[model samples]
Target: MAASGAAVLHRAVRANLTARALALVVVVLVLVISYATSLRIYFAQAHEIATTKAEIAQSQASIADLQSQITRWNDPAYVSAQARERLGWLVPGETGYTVVGADGKPLGGGLTLDSTPTDDPGQPQAMWWDRMWGSVKAADKPAVKKADPGKRAPVTPDSKPR
Candidate 1:
């Protein structure tokens, strides 16, 4: 009976050892899975932070450029320069001269008023009202003659009639 009791005790110890080993393996696996999930989330958040920082830097650079432009526009000298260069403006006591080529095009993109057609060196320039009156008078004149339908040019395939 003493020998039998020893065998039973030995079997009980072996069963307890197997159960503890199995429980330890399951707990280890759960810990490893949780750690892997946490690492993935951490890396994703880190990447987002880096992207946001880059966008913030770009926005700051754009704001700086706009602020510099605003500062330049605030100056009166800058405004006057822009007007003279872009709009061909002339200030008081400044003589405005335009050079024309043989083709009659202005050399420096200078402003020309088409109203004064008969520009004479001896005569004074026409007033705005006089020019307007001249244009009105010209428009009041009727056409000398109308073209016959038979004389009209043949239409091309690419040309659409009005």
Candidate 2:
């Protein structure tokens, strides 16, 4: 009976040690999982903050560009330049002239007279009166001459016209 009692006491001690070991393992695992979760959250928040800062910088740059454009628009020179380029406006005391090509379209470089005349005189020269008469004749010619429908005769399908 004494030996049996000692065996039972040894088994109880072993069971208690196993339970304590299992509890310790569970606590360690929970600590490891919580630490990993905290690390993930921290990294995510850091990335978000970095992205937000970049967006803010980009927005600030756009705002600066808009402000600069506004300042330029506020200037009289800039406004005049825009009006001259966009609206074909003539400056005060400046004569407005247009050079038209044979196609009845305005010559390129729009109306600004800043072009330097080239010294190349290879082109044929016509008298001023002749050139004026030529332009008058060209302008007199219609761009599209409509066919005189009344001058045409109606034909039947059997006419077999070529």
Candidate 3:
């Protein structure tokens, strides 16, 4: 009887030890998961902060570039040069000549004007008032739509064919 009682006591102690060890392991696992989540959040925020800072730096650089351009544009010499190059503007009393290619298009190294010459130089352009009156006449007339050759006109049962 004494031996049996000792055996039961030893088993109880082992079971208690195992329960305690399991509880400790569970607590450690929970703590590790919580710490990992916190670290992940911290890293994500750090990355976002770095990206924002980079964007701010890029914007500041662009602003500085625009400011420099503005400074350049404020100069009269730069404005004159831009006008001569871009618009082919000439100083007063100075004659300007444009070299025309065989195709009637102007040939130069400078920036080309957006407005191209008329296809036929001999054809006279209509006066502004004439164009306006023609546009008015056109607008007064109702729009006429042509029927599609591929499609047949719809026939109603009440209508008789002539």
Q: Give lDDT per model, in order.
A: 0.90, 0.88, 0.93
Judged by whole-model lDDT over C-alpha atoms, candidate 3 comes out at: 0.93
TM-score of each: 0.49, 0.51, 0.63
Candidate 1 residues lying further than 4 Å off, grouped into runs, are 1-22, 98-162
Worst 10 residues of 2 by lDDT: 110-119
Descending-TM-score candidate ranking = 3, 2, 1
Q: Number of backbone collisions per candidate, in order?
A: 0, 0, 0
What ordering of candidates by lDDT runs from best to worst? 3, 1, 2
lDDT of 1: 0.90
Model 1, 1-162: lDDT tens digits are 999999999999999999999999999999999999999999999999999999999999999999999999999999998888877898999997878789988886545667755778788988899999999999999769887999988899988888
User: Which number leads on TM-score?
Assistant: 3
C-alpha lDDT of residue 27 in model 3: 100
User: Residue-wise lDDT of candidate 3 within 81-153, one digit each (tens)?
Assistant: 9999888899999999989899998887776757766757787888899999999999999799897867966
Kindly report which residue pairs in candidate 1 clash with one another. Answer: none
Q: What CA RMSD would you report for each candidate?
A: 14.6, 16.4, 6.1
Name the candidate, 2 or 3, with the larger lDDT value: 3
* Top candidate by lDDT: 3
Write down the TM-score for model 3.
Answer: 0.63
